[model samples]
Target chain A: MRGCADVRALLGDEAVYEAAAAEAFPEYNKAHLVSLELPDRSGDIIITTYGELDKNNYLDPRTAQVATVNHIKQNCTELRPAADEELPSAYIEEFRSALDVELSKYVGEAYPKGVCAVYCTSGKDIEGPGANFGFAAVISAARRSPQNFCNGSWRSIWTLEFSDESQFVEIKGKIQVGAHYFEEGNVQLDTNIDYKYSTILQSAEDCAVSVTNIIRHHESEYLSSLEESYLNLSDATFKDLRRKLPVTRTLFAWHNTLALSLTRDLAKELAIGK
Target chain B: MEAAMDLVRRMPPGSTETALNALLSLLPDHSIDLLSQVDLPLQVCMDKESLKEYILCEYNRDADSYRSPWSNKYEPPLEDGTVPSEDMRNLEIEANEVFSVYRDQYYEGGISSVYIWEDEDKGFIACFLIKKDGQGKRGYMQIGSWDAIHVIQVGPEEEGAAHYCLNSTVMLSLTTDNKQSGTFNLSGSIRRQMSMTLAVADGHLVNMGKMIEEMEGKLRNSLDQVYFGKTKEMVCTLRPPPEVLNMRLPDR
Candidate 1:
């Protein structure tokens, strides 16, 4: 779908988001856009992914599902893409400026290094020639709000090619955490280390998979739980592509905040990137 | 037919005693000795005093001789010269799980008991710590038979972090079950500290870690309730559940 306008109407002048869906497009609304008003950082963020991506897109869902389970909630926001240089420059600048305010959360000296930015195009139709960030920085940047990809945060372009609506699902990178990183919160570790796809999953792949996996985990109840429980996760097999560190303990609390935020009011409230 | 039904109702793990009677009524081919071998926990047979106790308590001695000795025999010498013989018998058991030797023995002078030995490997992967009554009825008690003493070494999967606690003391207890009802306490010490580096090359150890912690021998109330959807149904696994009977250890 193209040019849907539900989120902006919902925000009602509140700078949290701008959304668009198939209601604006001719066909059914199979696509969505979400942009966030990062009130505390440098620039804003826009996340978008197809509504029908499968769960197999992610490398590992079981060991990694707990990465942000409790923090999830029911979030269904309508996101609108930014018009190109054709649109008003001031409003777009305002959105980007809000993100700069959010960036302050992780701007300290010890902030992670090797950040990368990766995004995908379903139709390969991204028309903007913006300064592209590296994958490491891209992922590092998204850390403040990974769920944006699933909610209303969509960027400026929808790569439409031969009837295919294109989009960048995720941006990639690692935070270079230390040896003493124990995720002992209701939910922690915003992302996962073990990925399963054979294709080198760009950050685009990670975002698509993460969003799709969440939708799938919540779609039906315990139908897939057995498959999740007994799969052959023999080792941290993806460790070769990863760095190693001695972790004392990590408790991934589920049935709590992570799932709540991701499942419920994330897209509507506390809309980080969207 | 009357005799066959009586045999069915006599005891738990007692189908062996009814074998001849059940077979007599059926065609020769209808009854087959599917039994291929007799193994033991350590090849030790029931002690003499316990054998007397079995007969006196109306335990069918005819079936006693046919069961696996190590699993059937219950005797640990309390006297000065008996430990070595017991050790020798146990040593042979470790060699192969196909055969067992049972004997009769008295432990606390007045306490007579049946000693049963199964495969030294998987069947009893976790050493069950059993606590018997200073005075009670006799049999190779299964679930509902006796309280269980949990031990660390009882499960088959003790390797990494678990082996360090010298968790050599896995204690279990017998909950509710389908036989003579009274919990017995079973307990034991690992001959060694244990090794987490156990190389489970292939078959029988895919879930080696889990088997070390819990195996197929014992059953729980949950399995039946979960599997059969009944609150207290005993039809779990078509066999008696492994009850956690003896749980005195504070560590468990």
Candidate 2:
């Protein structure tokens, strides 16, 4: 059985990506690298501190400022890791860059206190590192002050290991708020407050199994069709993946995107403002 | 023997009644009057209505007097209170028309096949092979007597083609015996929906009218083979080749 190629390889040539990034951001090469074990400790991710080693810039600013305040609010916490699984070492930079792009869009005036960056290195068996923009934590920290953390985004990363040749990793993040924080400048606090995420998943597993489970409803044709869209991973596109492996997408959305979105709303419900 | 040969010569060829009459005429003059009904048709027993009547007579003869009222006595009410007379009349008229039309079509080359078996005891069986236009669409239709345990089955020659069977009067089956193996027994409506879903998935369901027309053509072709083969077998069984009939006739 021919196993699938690495997900990075499937995406495109790595040299082109590195060259493009170097041309786009000169600061990208000059950044100082620091590895931190994630809070839940699934693995570690390497953080590139764009040209500086200042640790203060990465911690939530609201938490740093709240030390001066007399009244301290409860710190909003994150959901614990469901399982201690590590991501692959070779794919860490890709994961970090993807998260960086997603989180950069959320660090606007909408989140009054601004966003923070954090990194986690791969585990004992894992070689890659992952990064997250602590947008949800920023909101929680912001809630400690008299500021309303209304609109922003947060990220989540999930890694799954199949006993076979390829490893499946999904990187997704929440982008938009569902409820109106304040109506006509009056706070209309409703229990229906929710957060929704735009999801993206990258999986490198046996193409046959992935594609079959994608269309699990049509179980009858899975085996014969295993080689067609599935093993043809040499140049499989997102559209092809979406069409062929719909179940994988649903699973990725459920595990990474929906789970993260729920965690954000759960944090708000538990301790963010109240 | 001489009188029996004369009676056989006088009777019309291919008339089961005449054949039975000739056979009975072979009996001694004293014993000829013993049989109350001596002119029954040779193939009359195979007719659907005759079969039903024979079954009813046998059942009633052996039936216990205390048998439950709900037991199938093979006696259905001619006029039931639940069914209006007008509706019943309409149904009977429609049924007669359908049978007549199909019978006419079935006899006139509607089906096509070779008769492999023609035995009065074992009954008629037709062996037919149909190769559809597409490459993977070859199959065989094995049709036996209507009352046979395994009456009819349409199956792919190898695999990958659609398969269906009518095992009994009440049982209709669709089989997925391609790379995968699964079978579904569905009613008329459910089967229609399933085939429609398959057609839609294949992008041929854009025009239902055309799809239905194509289906009708396919069905007619298949039925033509099945019925035509079956009819040939039955014809051979009821009226043996003239040479064999002549060999069986008493010498002048």
Tell me the TM-score of candidate 2's A chain. Answer: 0.23
**TM of each candidate vs. truth:** 0.18, 0.16
Q: Report the lDDT tens digits of candidate 1 across residue range B130-211.
A: 2223222222223222222222232233443122112222112122211122122111111113334333332222222233
What's candidate 1's i-RMS value? Answer: 29.2
- List ranges where model 1 is wrong by over 4 Å: A1-274, B1-20, B30-46, B49-197, B200-213, B216-218, B221-252
Each candidate's chain B TM-score? 0.26, 0.20
lDDT of 2 by residue, A116-232 (tens): 342333232444323322111111101111133121111112222222222333222211111112111111111111222222234322322332232222211321222221223
- Local lDDT at B100 for model 2: 25
lDDT of 2 by residue, B1-252 (tens): 333333332222224245555345435452434232222211111123323211111112222221111122223322222221343233332322232222223222111111122224322221221111111112211111111011222232223232222221111111111222121111010011113222222111112222322333333333233322232222223223345546655852
Compared with the true structure, all predictions reach lDDT values of: 0.23, 0.25
TM-score of 1: 0.18
Best by TM-score: 1
DockQ of each: 0.01, 0.00
Query: Where is model 2 chain A poorest over a 10-residue stretch in terms of lDDT?
Result: A65-74
